[model samples]
Target: MPGIVPRGRRGPEVAGTGEDDSVWAEGQVRTITDLARLAGVSAGTVSRALAGNTLVNARTRERIQQLARSHGFQLNQMASNLRRQKTGVVGVAIPLGHDRRQQISDGFFMTLLGHLADELTQRGYDLMLRRVLPERDEDWLSRFSGSGMVDGLIVIGQSDQFERIEAAAAEYLPMVVWGNHQEGQRHCVVGTDNRLGGRLAAERLIAAGATRLAFFGDAEPMEFAARFAGACDVAARAGVSILACPTSLSVEPMTREIAHHLHSNAGGFDGIFAATDTIAVACLKALRDAGRAVPGHVRLVGFDDLPIASQTSPPLTTIRQDIAAGARALVDLLMRRLGGENTESLVMPPRLIARGTA
Candidate 1:
């Protein structure tokens, strides 16, 4: 079915439906370039006319359109877009496993992604996800940014490896970051005020009568540290001590480290503030196994009210961030970018979720 056409009425009406799968599923394109060249014009010009480019000459454009109409070329979008100089795709760069999981999924990235996708689709653009690694160089970002692959990009997640991110942003690849801190001000950021969320968590813990507190974190992701800073400021103001947890791969490894600290300081600790629910859940399990009674011995507070947070033994008291809000914010930013508008960075507030752990 190389150049097959369905049994139908003869002419222009046939152009739109020639590629219908029922009739053309096994049809071959061979090369649209070959067809464009046969019409005595540049391939780009031939495409411009086929895609309704107003910049193309009138009579010549109509002839090109008529020629394409004759061959059923207008039936395939991929063929027409090649002439229009539009990729019809957006590249979304999200940091892989680089930040607090709760915010990434439950708070910020997930919602922003859904909204961005919806908005782009409404405006006739397709989403193209590109995972940015901590060790990627400028070369990777450049090739990824080239016009044919995607027309624009959205960068999400706060990375500990800011240098790599910075290098990529320096390319000016029509990209924006999910956060506004130094990285966003220096480049482009679309995120919420995580520091305020941290302060709010600290305020809740202090109100709970838990004075001796410890904080746990998986990595020094910017937003994670901001949460830690907010807690530290609150602890300082309350005249309480706060311990930041050392970095480790998972709950088990971190538990071993926290257990050593607990052993070293017998009655010096009472409450633990975990930056993520995953780490918090791990710490809670480890503390319980070590014969430390939760609430009765060590009250706990975790960030991101994850699904499993409530199912835990005594449950987890935590903070709730607006994931949908963040998503909307991101999509709004992207829409603005699409419309040639320059927008400032945004940081939404965080809410506290109380349960059994605290």
Candidate 2:
């Protein structure tokens, strides 16, 4: 599933879970019907947004049209490079990052792009950023196959969308995935040891003498799940009882969603392993608010080691994915493809960043 959509009326919500409420599936196919109804604007607004024209006054219309245009523009930029006898255009398809709203703000993806773009620029290739929402995977196939806007592609998606992306890679284009890609003849992947990260989080907590642990937040993410599973495996070896609770971004970060879990399960748990830095820090906040003490009430460990990790009162001990290393690895593969060399997948190790939380 596309993670657990929270409960709400307008935003991405699951409403009330039952046999019917969940709409997410691993490797699921998406269609325009799942896209927003906001695309129903007049063609004029679409044109303005696409062209970045000031004539479009509606912000929502602008966002929609600009999104489409940015995608098309990048594609054409790729084609334009081919005509010049040297197409510096390197196409990159990043996951939507959020729901239908097209949140292109995934920090790891952004950081990777920053490093990837710098590396590509040094080699005379221009980065063509494309927002590949779930519904547009098929469109990317056709566009990349014939658009000439890009000579190569690097796809960044989570496990939830990886397999669907794999199908397109198998059929067309010179493409590599940024993270754990399902095994296939044509697909290459570069990522860190996610399971190791989970293990590190668990070990950190265990060393601090936490016996009851739970990995929360994106605990359900494939990568995070690996972390949780690894932690669970170790916790089991240590006779530690661990629970994994997943929370969605659509819900308030550290509010009732966490309080509900903590309040209900706080009895024996003394350690928390969060899947994301965002959720981990928030959990820390909630833990304090609920009168639970860190390292005393509970020890916390988070993944990603985002900047805020160090700012939290007790600091955070977490696993750090070498995003820079992953980005460099991706660029190496892309360069190999550009050089007509054999494409190979690369996997890096996730480093553990130790601080006071655990």
Candidate 3:
């Protein structure tokens, strides 16, 4: 008898003959149901047989496998994942609350994202990225978590949405964040100790003979704020003055802002501690434009010893946050959370990388 056509395939169903082992035509067994009917077994049996569930009798499993191969039957991964209640995907969100203009192409973010992609791919999960604006959507975290598109979430930055993330963490278990760790926060986080990093940067500047320090970058974001606080901790103890020079993370405005700060405070500060290496690089350029020598007339330091840090004309001395290790920790914590484990926050120590600038 003619074989049955699979549902959703564009074909007419052929009447089945009374034979017990009739050959299913190509394209006829496109789905489990189609394959099961041809093999004279239930859909569950076909699924178990396809999955090599040893519970299915050996002869029946072999018969089903041969039929599936002969008819070119392929399992629907989406359907299988749905049955298992998983999407096999992880969401990577970058919330731009403090700097709405910040792009994912920013050096620091790009570097971290590349590491995250590598870590996620190695663990058999696909990455779905989204750039969110918390100002526009107060429920951004809830929406992303409830969208059911991803199995877990890895928020790249806290931005200015710490409260929102905390609220979401109360409900969502399989979420991890990369940002500063507070004394008490609800969400699971894996990140560098920004406060310590800031302290290290400031101390390095002070040891380099900088009496007055200027912090370049916005201090609103929690991570940056902690870094600023750390720097303040060191500055206050050493009796050296530190000033926050708010700079944007976006490239165009960042350059312009750094130039203005340098032009306006050329003789005011002897040391500069940029919030990030990207900002430090921009500050380096601004200093060059203003003809202020790095570590000669003014000491400069940065955070996140990214690749470009060493490649700069006068290599940047910065605090190093292990991005790759952070990525691994984020994934590991998220997987643990997925497994119903209550993982604690992981704050990795930041090491000071001494290069030419400082």
Q: What lDDT tens digits, residue by residue, belong to model 2 across residues 1-358?
A: 5776533233365563533323453212121212222356665555455556777667865677555544332233333356465566788876663333322454555677888888878878788887766564646544754577677888775646655666776665467777653345356788777777778888889999888888786554466667777888889888989886767544354456788898888686889998777778878889989998887869998887766788888998888988777777888887776677767777677778888888
Task: Give the Cα-based TM-score of candidate 3 against the true structure.
Answer: 0.89
How high is each candidate's TM-score? 0.71, 0.71, 0.89
Model 3: residues with Cα > 4 Å off, grouped in runs = 1-29, 37-41, 57-73
Clashes per candidate (backbone, < 3 Å): 8, 6, 0
| Alpha carbon deviation, residue 235, candidate 2 (Å) | 1.9
The lDDT values for all models are: 0.68, 0.69, 0.89
**Candidate 2 residue 251 C-alpha distance from true site, Å:** 6.7
Candidate 3 residue pairs in backbone clash: none
Each model's Cα RMSD:
7.6, 17.6, 4.2
Where model 2 places Cα greater than 4 Å from the true spot, the runs are 1-86, 97-103, 136-138, 171-173, 181-186, 250-254
Q: State the lDDT of candidate 3 residue by residue for 72-94, as single tens digits.
A: 78899788887898888999999
